[model samples]
Target: MLTPTGEIVAEARRLGVGAGAFNVITVEHAEAVVSGAEAAGCAVILQISENAVRFHHGRLAPIAAAARAVAELSTVAVGLHLDHVESDELFDQAAANGFGSAMYDASKLEYADNVAATACAVARGHAAGLWVESELGEVGGKDGAHKPGVRTNPAEAAAFVQSTGVDALAVAVGSSHAMTNRDARLDHELIELLHDAVSVPLVLHGSSGVPDDELRAAVRGGLVKINIGTALNIAFTGAIRAAIAQDVTVVDPRKYLRTARHDMAETVTKALRVLTGATP
Candidate 1:
């Protein structure tokens, strides 16, 4: 059923478990995420990125509404989250479009500017009764300004949350964004230190780059929210390729899409089991 992000995440914190926040770009992604969560008997967050909004020609309302409906109807608790939104207008759009929570990515800005902008977003999101998450420092492995060695400081992270009043904080703990391979090594020591220092929940971005064993360990080490994107993209693209190779004459969208969705669902389920330690 549809629930507040704070409620879902707070329960996770209490239970010593992390919630999977999968990025969604299509209807199939949404279906597979919900199905995976239900199958795992765990709550999940379905996220739509700023890039996704741009891909859909700026019409996020319909897409967000559909995701929200799926979350509302799911057997397990689910949250519709807007990810990496930089503008207040975008955050406003997401809040109005039925998103339960959102992350405003002001990491590209200067430290003070990022803090100010994120604070504004937090205020607006709280006013709308939506949970807000923000990134302090940068996660490496992406084309962004942050380099791989630039890790978030524990003291800085704690201060950022205290000043901004956000529900969660995404800190750089050694994982990079959009990594196709699972070779990134996380500083488990840093993760534990940050967890001890920060009162808010810790979010791990670019988790797709981390191996399955490391992911489970990160959660065990106190990371609360894991954001995965590239792995799902890999499953989706690989399934499409496999389906096309098997039937060269099949041109129907449903034929290949059905195969892709099934593959994606299995991938999600596998990730859920590893990260959340949930078993059927």
Candidate 2:
């Protein structure tokens, strides 16, 4: 069933669990994410990032349409979200194209400027009845420019959310984006502080850097939404490599693509289990 992002977040809040949001670059990715959610009997979010739109020549309609189709056809609840979108135009496009939620990222700008931009985006998204997410500080891995010690101030985070009226807040504690290793240590105390200070749900970006145990701990400490990308890509591509290596003469795209999709689905299922504290 197709679900709104706000509803998904509310469920996570009610259950005291973290909702997993997976980035989808292709139709296969969308299908795999939904399949994983169904396997876990949990709801999941399907996210399309600005980088993915750029990869598709700035066109969001096609991918958004495909994700919507997949979500509607799936048995488990699914929400479509636009992740880390910096441009107003693209954000508007995402809302128009049926994305139930969007993360307006203006973290590169000065503090006040980022707030103003994100506020405007929030208003626009609200007008379209879309759940809005925004980041306070840089969440690291922005082309390797993030400082290791940069963390979101709890007071500033509360102020930002009050000012922007965003539905969710992505805070920088210690995780960095695009991390290949899942060793980033999160500040459990800071997560609790932010959760207490902010009125909305707290989101953890660059969650791929945090290992499974740390992720469960983060959830227990107060994180609500977890955005994962690199780990799934690693699982997907690794399966493709293994498939090709296993059959040197195989040329059919479906043969290898099937394995890639299945592997990604398994990864998402495991992640959901961890985030929701389900027994494996």
Candidate 3:
């Protein structure tokens, strides 16, 4: 069933569980995520990122439509989410095309600018009846730590959420974006403190880097919406590589991609279970 992000994440929060938000780059990615969601009988968020939009040549309507269709047809509730969108126009574009929620990344800008831009985006999203999520200071990825060794301050996080009126907050506890290895260490104490200070559900970006045990602990600590990307990509690409290596002359795209999608589905299903506190 198709539902709003607020409804989906709220349930996870109420049940003391975490909701997995997977970044879908292709139709196969969407199918894999939906398949995983049904296997777990859990609600999942399908996110289309800015990089994906760029890869699709600045068009999200087609992909967004397909995702919405999948959500409606799926047995489990699913939310269409726009992830790491940095531009106001793109945010509006996604909301117009039918995204249930969007994360406006103004973390690169100055603190005041980040707050203002995020606040404006939040207003626009709320006006369109869509959920908005934003980050405070900048959760630095490979671009070097924001402010050289800073994590999200509980008071500051609460202030940011209160000021912007965002439905969710993505904080930099310790994980970095685009990490291929699941070895990033998270500040569990900060996660709990932020949870105590803020009223909204916390979001953990770049969750693909955190190990399975640490991820489960993060949810136990406070994280509600967890964003995973590279991990699934690894599964997809790994299968693709193996398929081609096994049959070098296999020129048919469908054969290799079909196997890849199945592999991705299996990995995603495992991740979803960990997020939902079910045995893997």
Which whole-number lDDT from 0 to 100 does residue 4 have in model 2?
95
- Measure candidate 1: CA RMSD: 1.2
Question: Candidate 2, residues 1-280: lDDT per residue as tens digits?
Answer: 7899989989999899999999999999999999999999999999999999989899999988999999999998899999999888999987688889999999888889988999999998999999999998778887855566789999999999988899999999899888989899999999899989999999999988899989998999889999999888998899999999999999998999999999999999999999999998
Predicted candidate 3 versus true structure: per-residue lDDT over 103-218, tens digit per residue:
99888787777788889999999888889988874565645645434588899888888888988999989887878988888999999999999999999988888998999999
Candidate 2: residue 121 Cα off by (Å): 0.8
Cα error, residue 93 of model 1, in Å, equals 1.4
Show model 1 residue runs off by greater than 4 Å.
Answer: none
**Higher-scoring candidate on TM-score, 1 or 2:** 2
TM-score of each: 0.97, 0.98, 0.96
Candidates sorted by lDDT, best first = 2, 3, 1
Best-fitting candidate, scored by TM-score: 2
Please give the TM-score that candidate 3 achieves against the real structure.
0.96
**Mind giving the per-residue lDDT tens digits that candidate 1 earns over 200-233?**
9999999988998889889989998889888888
Query: Which residue ranges in model 2 land beyond 4 Å of their true spot?
Result: none
Please list the C-alpha lDDT of all candidates, in the order they appear.
0.87, 0.92, 0.88
- Clashing residue pairs in candidate 3 are none
Candidate 3 stretches greater than 4 Å from native: 142-149
